[model samples]
Target: MKKYLPLIILLFAFIKTNAQYSGALPSYKLVSGNDWAKAKNYYLLTLLQQDAEAAKLLKADAGLAKLTADKIALLKSSLAECKDALCLPAKLKFTDDEINTVAERLAALCKPGSALDKLIKTHIIPSGTYFQFQTLAPAQLLEKAWRQDAAAINHTIAVYAEGAKPNYPQIDSISYNVKKRGYYTLMYDCSAEVNETVNARSLFFEPSLKGALTYLEVNERMQAGDYEPMATTVNKPAADKVKLTKWANYPYTHIVVPGAGPDDPNTPFSGEGMLRCKSAARAYFAGKAPFVVVSGGAVHPFKTKYNEAVEMKKYMIAKLHVPASVIIIEPHARHTTTNLRNDARIAFRYGISFSKPGLIVTDKYQNDFIMNMDKRCLQELGYLPYKLGKRLSDTELEFYPLVNSLQIDLDEPMDP
Candidate 1:
């Protein structure tokens, strides 16, 4: 009960923010989908925490260490004083010298025969192969990770701050809700008792991190072991089914249906969403593929209780009579980019062959949107999640999944 206390309170407290249109709080387990509790989705932080020698190197540099502490303190001060999201980033941005110094120290591990290099090769690189850290010199990788981590932290704070508009529609409401609670306002006073509870659950006060990084991690206590081993919970049957599947018999490995979330808060599934599922079900019945992969998260009209994939799977099974075994629910992707990326991850991990192309079944408008989204995918995800093959029809586009889609995205923390 003690360990569960934080989660219980957060579940009830944050749940209402959904009604008011704020986005869901970050869940680290869902973000990284691994047991990386300390670092969550930040690879550089994981490297340091796992290596005592590396942590010691940072701590031993009195100047850098002091600077780190000072920066953290400064962040706290700024949070107390900040009036808007725009000011937080300017206050927290890391200086070039600080980044270079830390990079130089950590890069020492990159020596060809060093233990750190070996760890990066055997552990880190495989953990996120899509990061393409292997292409970088050790120093370069360290610097890049450090800079990205710093920027990510700052970005989260800015998102949380009042008056900032996140690209994600509902997130702005979260910023508004937090401000209403007096979280970022100078005059809003919290009692010691309330402060203790806030430390356990608030984005600004997660127990595992201090200062701005706390904002980056979000709701750590509730997120602990949450949705971990996601493959086991969400897709274990599909994974098992894939083991016995005869891939050569099917023309395609899977039929993917990207979820269209309902815009109205009271609605469970959109008409477009139902149509998309119907389309995939039609393809499945046509013997187009052995499985239908539904991709989406609880993202629509700001933190609606409905999850797009979960609702779509229910519709498929109940209405369309699609077998439960053949419908794989990927209930994490928020955008169309992640819809493809996460489904590709499903394909790779669940024994679907990347060699065989998968067919995407969606409305003609969405199909056109997807085909022309190369620029958007590259801009947002830094790489394409799939290799486009051909246009089989207006409703179908042929695509081969890319392994790079497995890379964790820290930028989009909610669905990373």
Candidate 2:
């Protein structure tokens, strides 16, 4: 019996030590249908409580340990429903002093074949350790060290809402090629009889002598001494006439003047000015090019405008005797930028090359912006199978200056 006394005492000590190490880590449950931020807040509170209990255990402070343990128990009971649970050693609040103290205590308690020993082997060593201690068994020191490290990580995450910006892949370069080109012209809202109050819907010129006379004036002013009597041939003195392979007319498509919709009865003829302008452009291009590209689409979601291209094609066929097969209707373009990009793509598909000069027919006022966009599109095409040439000659520069003056003068009254 005397010889067996030491073994009995050892067993008792073992049982006593293990008695204190009861209870699982607080279970974290996210509230259902809650946003991530709210869930994270709940999770953080549980973790903070765990940290406090773990700290108390390291100090061999029974009163502090009991207090923290009670708090953790309460939290665990209150948790809604946890899908999964992780068991972790109690950790004190993250602080330099607390970490050092916990590290030292963990070293002292570490031993072979102990709970701490298994935890260190299973969780800590595989990951890494932050606290340094010589006397403690290295194999059993990980759990406490890991807890300290995790606490620090959490604190860091709390300080910065989001971490670091990630690096993205870089594009090396870009290339471009010009596919095709053809004659282009601009039509305008002009009247020889009288200056008209051009609104959104009002056709600037009637399909009569008045309209024809206005077109003539615009043509004469633009061509000056260079005006040809009829669309005879490509007669620019700079180059010999090569056989014309193809011809297309691209119209500005739509013009929506401000204050011209269902809400504005007073501006009943709001779009008329644009429609008239487009008509003139169509007539001019029909006279110049054998094949014309009509470009326009639906104006409003519920309503449709006379597609500038369709109307122009009709005018060309009915009035000018051009063949229906000569016109290509591109009705999908919604904005000026998209119109250029889509047109360039179409031109490339049709074998239009930079070797041939392309003309952009648009409103005189919008000529510069369209020309700039065209140049950008060509640049995007890069060095391709053929060269593309672009010339902006249809829209008179004077009209743009006049439009700018009008816009500025009306700015104050037009502000919503």
Candidate 3:
């Protein structure tokens, strides 16, 4: 049995890595700095703007120049025949040849000593603190990230091209226009087109480029900046406190409390949520870990103003008598998958030791579900955020942080 232990561990890892993540994910957000930004904005313009040398090379390159011109011409020609935003996506989406040309131009910039290589080293590489993209060559990493962004932009074109309807239509408090035709606004007025000249670069990233604009307009959360610069916003005092404490003495790095959103629309925090928070507070007092991370976002009951993590933190402090200095609030995870992933992300970014396992303290049902959460994580997050270790008890399980948790999932823009 002792000799077979190594083989058992290898088998578990093998099963996890091979989990299927098929089809294009619904959305994407590229990491600009510490925060994730809209993928469409980044790829279409921001990337070039940030790296002037690389931008100059791409803009000057004959391939991109010709591709841009051709795409602009195509869009200009189609504008007269196109009736509305719905008719423009087919004209604006990248063709295989155009994509290949763009890829080639970007590939040129990945060479050693090039401007893009420098940008990659300084910006892209450092964004993922855990060296998430170390396995991929610079070119491969750039191409993969760019392609995913393109796919996300294209997806928005298809889903929100006509215009997105509000996710919660039944709620009367939301305006009629918001309820009926979310993001009815457009970048260009298509009401009666006689054609003004479109910018070459903008033309190069059409339909979805337009769709990305509408998506942001509809979501209206492009700039909420909820708990951003989390290094300072939520983790500062706790991180500072942790610095003076001896981590080796604790059995766990942190006691993670994944938020259980309220079922009632008007309710800010649920009973189940309190149960989870109480469990974590108990673990903290017992010296299970040095910190308590309450993980969640504005999710349940759709468009509810209350944030689960924020509410939970209040509960723990006011009700449980938990010290504010020892609690970290992760207020941007919309789902159970992100709850775990975001918790791990907070742990990694806040100087928590990945070598030390974190204990997840939740209700028995959630704890049991977590034991089989690998499939769900893979399906939604494309990789397991943490490696599941031993189950400490009925309501507590141990998990080690994974570097791959840094890989941003753009599907949930509000939280990503």
Q: Output the number of the lDDT-best candidate.
A: 3
TM match of model 2 to true structure: 0.26
lDDT for every model? 0.64, 0.31, 0.65
> What is residue 390's positional error in candidate 1, in angstroms?
2.7
| lDDT (tens digit, per residue) of candidate 2 on 88-180 | 101112335434544455555556665456544443322111212212455444444434333433332221111111111011000111111
Worst 10 residues of 2 by lDDT: 407-416
Q: Work out the TM-score per prediction.
A: 0.76, 0.26, 0.78
Tens digits of per-residue lDDT for model 3 on 1-416?
99999999998755553231111111112444332345322432345455668677667767767776776666676656764445564565656666666677777767988777776655555455223444577776666666655655554444444344322233211222322322233423431131343466533444335445444444454432476656565768896786687888999999889888777889999999998888888899998898999988777776677889899999999999999999998887776787888887666656677777999999999889999999988887778998989998988999987766767554444544
Ranking by lDDT: 3, 1, 2
- How much is 57 displaced in model 2, in angstroms? 59
Name the candidate, 1 or 2, with the larger TM-score value: 1
lDDT of 1 at 294: 94
lDDT of 1 by residue, 96-148 (tens): 66656656666764577665565555555444522645457656665676666
Candidate 2 ranges with C-alpha deviation above 4 Å? 1-288, 301-306, 372-416
The list of candidate 3 runs beyond 4 A from truth reads: 1-36, 39-47, 69-81, 88-96, 129-133, 162-213, 221-225
lDDT for 352 in candidate 3 is 79
